[model samples]
Target: EFRDMKTEEPEVAPSPEKDKFEIIGKSTSRIDGEKIVTGRAPYTHDIKLRGMLYGKILRSPHACAEVISMDISQVQSLPGVKAAIQLKKGRVTYAGEQVAAVAAVDEKTAEQALKLIKVEYKSLPFAVTEEKAMEEGAPQVRKRPNVQKFNEYTRGNIDKGFKEADFVLENTYKTAVEIHHPAETHGSVAKWEGERLTVWDSTQAIFGVRDGLARALKIPASRIKVIKHYMGGGFGSKLGINDYTVAAAMLAKQANKPVKIILSRRENSLCVGNRPSSLQTIKGGVKKDGTLTALYLKNYTSGGIGRGDYCSEPVVDLYKCPNVQVEEHSVFTNTGASRPTRAPGHVQGTFALEGFLEELANKINLDPLELRKKNYSTKNQGDKETPYSSKGLNKCYQLGAEKIGWKRRNKRPGEGNGKVRRGLGVASQIWWGVGRAGTQADVKLHPDGSVEAICGTQDIGCGTRTYMATITAETLGLRPKDVTVKIGNTEYPWCGGSGGSTTTPSVAPAIRDAALKAADYLKKMAAENLEVKADDIIIGNRKFSN
Candidate 1:
């Protein structure tokens, strides 16, 4: 339901007054602050269901192996083990790939049951590094070639632009693989009532989990409810329906009781996700006056069995280069698949691009800040000739430069000959922020003068509840504390999972739209009560008057 937020909204002309938000800019304590600090907030890890059995997954010890034979007979007959089932068959691609799962009276029993299950495997030669994977005779991780060129983008003539440049620079920048796990490891609690299922999960996407469970359990999505009122943090680790969650659901059905599966910290690090390593080589051409003539990026990244990020967006869209080209390849390795880590490709791309630009500026004896200002374009060069509706990047650059005392910096890079030195640097990033289309939310105003703003978007330890309440309250001329924000349950109106910097933009406007509609209804009621025209009525200070 969160993904189906598509409603064609006509563009609204920009308004300066409408853009200035008083309530939004102010600082306020989080609405859930007290509950969290007091240890009363119920996260998925803290949930305890009646008759709930603890579950644990058995994983392959080998990085690359083919299953010769599987035996879970001993685990099933083990005392206190409620249910045991195999999750994977045939070839295991990564080291921590799920092989089987066991549910028992407690986590210890479940772990012991897993140890009793025996599986035979034929270990296969595998490469786990990007460099080794790209080698000529390295072991193949997949059917396809280890190094596969999956993406390419080009605009204008590459050769012509390079020839037009006064100076050209080429260098290779490498970024190592980065793995960051959330404070709360991936987990789920599943309970079954007749044919219906309810899941308490620590996930970024609730509807995504519901749909995934439907696909996995062979049940209708309508019969499944996924709830995540709070999360420690996602960092892009928890996005869709994880296998452990499905295992819990299946175990619950088999054991005729609730099942809870929480991943260990080791499992979280091994299977959840990581930011893939990148070996990016950039060849850039620039004119004497800091004009970017051409830009070319060739990147090879590895995410184990996962798709690597397209680490060329910064080169293609960041500047006003006439000729730009990108060649991105994924070098498959035998390790945990990569997931979106924060900005994913952008962080790595920006580091490489920004560093290259600084070096490029040094070559031309131009200030890097001035070089950025000189090439600022209101039109997006990467997209199909679309002009930006609004861009405040240049203002940000000016303010940041001024605040950092840019004039006091050394004229050359690492030029000062002193034991201790202070330096200033500047960089910029393009963030694509907007509400996901079709995101729906509801505002309920009870006869008792209470308000509730409901959406399916989960707050991943961010102050989503506070802001939702603030938006609704401000719209209805009430205090932020007066309105209650309810979210993290699929039972609420549809909203997509909270990630890609979309939660606030997507959920806030939807709630605001509903709040505005409620305000309209209130104004109509007040006008009829006072025998005045609806348009003449005004709303402020929690009152409607003519």
Candidate 2:
């Protein structure tokens, strides 16, 4: 009737040219493509209940302030107002920190009610940049030191390594904060059925939201259900439960009706998370023969009131270096916190490391690609020199150079006739793409010969639903259309949130195993009907025959 499957490590497979599979490596159309393009798919913002109320949040105008008092009596008395609650009554650390919320019959009424609530605040000195926050005698963003050493790493002796080098270079680089403005902004629609709460949210993690709500609302996880059918994007901003989601649920419970809350663009820009800004100073020593002698980095970054990213990973892992030292400090500013953007630290780290490597190659009068080859790392230096299971970087570089016609690159770095100069450059990156443990999938076989694959993973426009169907159909020896994919509901078999590029690798294996079990069952049933052994039967054109 049902099968639950889990896969931990990836099974090694033969090369694509030698292996044969029906749908595993083929190009198949996305299953949800028609529904999405036709605008028939139901996003969280499209959900509307019979007695739904629109919720709006009121945010602080000052970067740092202490709320003296709040008067919401007039807002509560409004005709269409259903519920009003104060979110923050004490010190606000950021400009857009939520201070209050109101739910009313319509969006206009909710917006109007927010204006009626009066709040008094006392402003405090604030730092808006990392330089300002790190300045001596600067206003303290938190109780701790303004610039706290967040993380550090050291390897061999830097002094001895630098002494062996022929030349050294040091420079500073900076990266600005970036926002994840997903097409569907952060939002939630909450409905309460007695003591149980069901929420439809545009989020990457349903279980994360469930756990966050349980902790915040003092309720059991079983009492909450999170669902998301289709999400425009998250890019890491929607990984955790947001304050707006909690506000909607509380408002819906108080008003005894469903509540919908969607953040405006400005609110999202100010309060929602971003990729923290980083200021890195890197020093490197290289020999004339293109061998790296020493590398040192000091990074200062700010994530507003939250911890900043660790931007020293590439420096330690990307190349072979004996002496390396990295120190990272995080400063707090009065702005939005930083969340994991796509690749988090690696993207920013790669930019700084590669830029410096290019300049180092030029200084040594060597080809950049050849210089990188001189210090290629076969093992992960960061993880105690563990040999990689497989490394295709050399092949990738060779192929890339061939495809790009590397021989035709400019001999001089900035040689061009017009103001526009053309140059060819390359950089490499490494990241975590491993599947998460404890992910699950379920497969069901119906008497009508139709199959269904069920998992709790949401499709964040990454072809998850299509791939789920593809894996199930491939394992069961059936067309993809014969399988029905059910996902984005917490009631289904548990799958981890879609992030870190983990959804396909995590869910596909489980789905494949479940389908294999279902296929075995179907084979057993077909053998009995065909008067032959299960292994003797052949499946073709959706038919099981002997």
Candidate 3:
């Protein structure tokens, strides 16, 4: 029998100074702290079941090649090799594209089987660099030239704005591609019980995997249930279902036994998503007094065999520039598709726009901080029509400057004589502070007066579980220890998968509001039992009293 968490008394002191006596903002230790520290967290690969097959994939070796022929006969004929598949006649568009896969009784056998499967390739001319592809005579990565999408945006008359400007500055900035190496490599353990499919995947969205499995296998959604109790990390790479997830499910169905497919570190790096490299140019005109007159930005980037766009997101809205023109272009390369990284496009934009602003400020003989302050807009300049929920950029700038002693910064570069250079650079930023849609939270107050907060969201080192506990405890007038947080289950209510730094602001309020509603119901019930109005009673000393 399971013990109810509510009945157990917490081993801590109780306080009742505030109207709502509970812990919210106080930095309570994470409930999963001990488990994580002790290496007791049950990750996806830790799962073990009866008679599970190991899966290994065969990959292409050429950057751009056509698979002319594949010989998997030796691999299939090998002992303990349960299944093997190859897509040879079809083009292997990328290096390390999964050509085939094998399931064997053991990892060693599965790996050996992969090597036995040989493939032939017809090499094709490849273009990796964006600049080379855009040249007059470069091999076409796709049917079109090295232009994925060339989009232009304008707010006002650019010629008029440039005419009004006393000065203009333009420069190009480049950023390199970054890989998403989640602590846990991408993998999935699929168990098929007759027609029913169950997948234990290392992923951010369980339902997304389920949907993919359902569609790929031509099975109903009800037949599939994907569970991801805990993930090492995804960084947006695991936001949707991946090819490996589908492969594992298919292998399990074919083998008539559970199959676990976990890629090696090398495989993860090759197949998993990565942030596309970017090259951006910003041209801004500014007045002598440090006011931005006009800004024009052009970005060139590659999504690597997929579509990508840079909306000039940071430049088009960051400052109070009236005349703005933004253009973006994304080209395809013979690499993996670009996945959304943290603050996608914004980080690149910040580096370019901020760096340019610093240069422009130097030209105008104005402090960078003061220049940004002069261009600060209480409203978002991107949409121009839509206002923000709240903007603390100006306040953050002032408070940060004062705390960091902005006045001490040397106005002239190369003035510092010390071995170590002391420099202060300030950049202004704003995030669209809204969470994803279709979120549901359930807060329950047991008869023994403990709280349980349930939601279908994962805590990827972001203190989401603890935040939910705080919200629940705050509403019920209870301490952190009195609340049990439950999450990362498809069985629970729906919630947007965590991304875009929207989890905290978006879901925290929903959890708090749900907890409050539950608490109000409980309060009314308790007051009726005590023969007093709900307003007459006060929450104190972890109990309802007069």
Judged by TM-score, which candidate is best?
A: 2
lDDT of 3: 0.78
Between prediction 2 and prediction 3, which has the larger lDDT?
Answer: 2
Alpha carbon RMSD to native, model 2: 2.4
User: Estimated TM-score per prediction?
Assistant: 0.95, 0.96, 0.91
Residue runs of model 2 more than 4 Å from their true location after superposition = 5-18, 382-384, 538-540
lDDT against the true structure, per candidate, is 0.86, 0.88, 0.78
Q: Give model 1's TM-score versus the native structure.
A: 0.95
List model 2 lDDT by residue over 1-546, tens digit each: 455542433332222242657677889998889999999999988999998999999999998999999999999889999999999978999899999999999999999999999999999999988888888998888899889898989999888889999989998989999999999888999999999999999999988898899999999999999999888899999999899999999999999999999999898799889998899999998898999989999998888999888999999998999999999999899888899899988888988999999888888888999988888888897434998899898888899999999989987589779999899998999886878777888888887888899988888889988988887887777888888999988888888878889988888877877777676778778899888998777565687877
TM-score for model 3?
Answer: 0.91
Superior by TM-score: candidate 1 or candidate 2: 2
- Per-residue lDDT tens digits for candidate 1, residues 33-70, read 99999999999999998888999999999989999888
- Flag the better candidate by TM-score, 1 or 3: 1
Model 3: colliding residue pairs: none
